[model samples]
Target: MNIVVIGAGLTGANAVEELRNQGYAGDITLIGAEPHLPYERPPLSKGLLLGTAEPGSVFAHDHDWYADHQVDLRLGSPVTELDLGRRRVGVTGTQIAYDRLLLATGASPRRLPLAEPSNPDVVYLRTLDDALRLRARLTGHILIIGAGWIGLEVAAAARQADATVTVVEAGSLPLLGVLGPELAPLFVGLHREHGVDLRLSTTVDSLTGTQVDLSDGTRIHADTVLVGIGAKPEDQLAAQAGLATDNGVLVDARLRTSDPHVCAAGDVANHDHPRLRRLRVEHWDNAIQQGKHAARTMLGDDTPYVRQPYFFTDQYDLGMEYVGHVGHAGYDEVVIRGDADTRVLTAFWIRDNEVRAGMHLNDWDAIDPIRSLVEQGTTDLDALRDPEAALPVPSG
Candidate 1:
């Protein structure tokens, strides 16, 4: 089989690796737009950005892995045309035919119109190169827009570097849209307690050079301005190929596109989930699992992709892992399992008297049981709520 995977990020690399491991000996070609080998992006905002991790530690595979596995690794070659009809992809002057194709094309950070492209002081973090450049500039006063995950993480890194950090978020809480009102306060207090001058419920009116004017008529000067206002899916190729795209390339429970021969994974796949509504996840776990799922589907596996959404973040002294999705339907109540006063706890988002989602902060022991509750569903809300009660709650 002549299989071609567009994208050399975490998804594509893992997908190709899975194919080899599954004992499918075929002509596999992995295409990448970036010159570098497939690498992980999480460290860009964490260890790499904080200068604690080695530069070469983020790559997904070694240089010889592709050759040893007989996978044609094409770097710096982007697919200019995705011709699903012809079952061929156009890369520069050549067209590569494929029996099966996987679009692991990931997402890019949102661009700010106010931030000039020529200005080095204004920046956005998405790639490894971007992280390296921003790490060296985490000095003096750092002004960040959007109190999203990326924004909050950079703020934490800046504070650790002894640089004054001010994060301006338009929402009432730091992660209002994601965590909602029930749990957003935890993050707001986390950043504020660690010396981040959080400007919540406010927007930037204008960006003039290094000075920013706020909607509240406050003016602030900044040494560097970092915009972490979330990211959008890179689904232009799928759209141009006449595939369904809403927020991202729409895929079914099997990760298959409108065309059966084509599949999309990672950040670009707007999955029609079995448990949840149509959603797209941009986390590291989703990318890895979905990539493997997409590859298996190409091999004629009928199993559905039903893994709940998962993501983790490390900011200040807090480390949190979240499972499941509440969606726009919202939650009925939030149950806590530790000292709410202190910086340690396990929280569960309950809906319709069922566990829809759960998260833990600085508590690793509760993760396995939390995952069980989110996936298997729990009947005992009383025992689940009790911090003293053992999890997976003793079902009679």
Candidate 2:
């Protein structure tokens, strides 16, 4: 059997590795748009931007690893055409046939009309190459539009670099939709404490030259302007191939697409999660675990990808790990544990005594229990918010 993976990001790499681990000796090919080998993206926003991690450290496998595994690794050229009916993909003017194809194409940065790519001063971060370009321009006054994860992380990196950073967000708090109102203020205070000129409920009216005019009629000068609103899934090839797509390439519980031979994972897959409904998760853990899951599904494993959604962030002194799923106004109660002043706390998003999701700030050890809490609702209502309470909370 011939297997081809479209993408060389963390998801693709992990999928290929999983195939090999599963003893699939059939021919395999991994295609990537970037020249660099498959690497993790978390560092692009965290340690790499902060200059604390080396460039080579983000890669999942070295060049020799692919060769040792006898995997045909294709880099730099993107697959432009996908003909699922004929089971062939056009790559660099060449057609490659595959018995099974995995679309781990990932996602692209959400572009803005005001921030033109032709403008050298304006930038966006998504890949290793993008991060490198943005890193070089981290100095001078940095004006970032959007208070999302990328924006806040870049703000933290710029402030640490002694660059005057001003962040403008249309929302009241950073990650308001994800974190919700109760725990959202903590992040607002964090960035403000770090000397970031964060303007909430504001947006960029215009990005002309080095000056950014705000909707509130305030203007800020910038040497480097980054637009980090969010990203849209790169499912054009899947869509063009006539595969089902909405927000991303739609996949079932086992990560199988509408067409049986074609499958998708990573940020490109809008999975029909059994427990959490239909959603797309763009995170390190999801990429790693779901990539493996998709590979197994391709190998005839009917096991559903039942893992809960998880993600983490490190900004200034605040480090957070969030588990499970909830929306902007999805939860009924926000229960918090530990000390708020010391910045060590665990917060739960609860709906009728059921823990929909949970997060911990600067409390690394709280993740497992948070997972357990999401899995098992607390027996005693008071135990949900008690750090001293034993884990799993013993459901009635």
Off by over 4 Å in 2: 377-379, 386-388, 391-396
Candidate 1 pairs with clashing backbones: none
Superposed by TM-score, candidate 2 places the C-alpha of residue 377 at a distance from the truth, in angstroms, of: 4.4
Off by over 4 Å in 1: 393-396
Over the stretch 1-396, how does candidate 2's per-residue lDDT look in tens digits? Answer: 999999999999999999999999999999999999999999998899888987899999999999999999999989989999999989999999999999999999889888766899888899887888888888999999899989999999889989999999999888889888877888888888889888999988888887889999998889999999899999988988899999999999999999999889999999998878799999999999999999999999999897889999998878999999885338888888888777898888888677889889998998987888786754466756566875545443
* lDDT against the true structure, each candidate: 0.91, 0.90
The number of the candidate with the highest TM-score is: 1
